[model samples]
Target: MKERKIALSQEDFAKINKAVQQAAAKGSKDSLILYRDLALVTSITNRTVITAIDGNNMAEHVFTNIDSAVIVK
Candidate 1:
């Protein structure tokens, strides 16, 4: 997948989303946002996100889900 979605507050998400939009629009900077979910038993990073950006190839993100459900296909 070229994006990740995690369980976060709407406001927090908005902030992150705004940054991405800005970067994408500005075409000056790029962003790679990583998100994760706590394990039911253990509280740890359960996911990973890897985003790649460039002049032409922008808005390409990746989501390596540790829980498999955070980023649905």
Candidate 2:
């Protein structure tokens, strides 16, 4: 028997697709990618990375903590 690992799901793909679509429509159609750092994540969100998580790299993002909510950039 073999174990299969799933990478991106439908919802996660939607979130990423939405960003790209929104960017294209708004003329901000630069290269958009999702990166995740499990270390900083603590938990997880629909914001999954397009790449595999290797301990060699730390995810890049700007976070704002406001009123118990976290905002990602």
Candidate 3:
């Protein structure tokens, strides 16, 4: 499969980073929902976002393999 890149502004990236940090503090090792529309499946143990989804594309989609969620707004 082709690799898809998600672009974020510096501020948006910072938001995501901060959210990730907070989730880590809570010992969250699951997918996180950011900005209501975006879903970030992260590995708290690895401190990385494995995958992401935008709101427009989240319609008719089911999020599985996730244990947690965080709203950035």
TM, every model: 0.32, 0.38, 0.77
lDDT of 3: 0.73
Cα lDDT, model 2, residue 59? 45
* Best by the lDDT measure: 3
Tell me which of candidates 2 and 3 scores higher on TM-score: 3
Off by over 4 Å in 3: 1-5
- Residue 32, candidate 1: how far off, in angstroms? 4.8
Residue 57 of model 3 has an lDDT of 69
Residue pairs clashing in model 3 are none
The lowest-lDDT stretch of 10 consecutive residues in candidate 2 is 63-72
**RMSD values, in order shown:** 15.1, 10.8, 2.5
Q: Please, what are the lDDT tens digits per residue for candidate 3 over residues 1-73?
A: 0144567788987887788888778878775656656777777768777777777667787777777778888
Give the per-residue lDDT digits (tens) of candidate 2, residues 1-73.
0122335568755655565454445543233333332212211223333233323443464433211222123
lDDT of 1 at 45: 35
The TM-score, computed over Cα atoms with residue i paired to residue i, of candidate 1 is 0.32
Evaluate model 1: give its lDDT: 0.34
Candidate number achieving the greatest TM-score relative to the actual structure: 3
Q: How would you encode candidate 1's per-residue C-alpha lDDT over 1-73 as one tens digit per residue?
A: 2233334578755654554444445442323443332111111232122332332333353333322222111
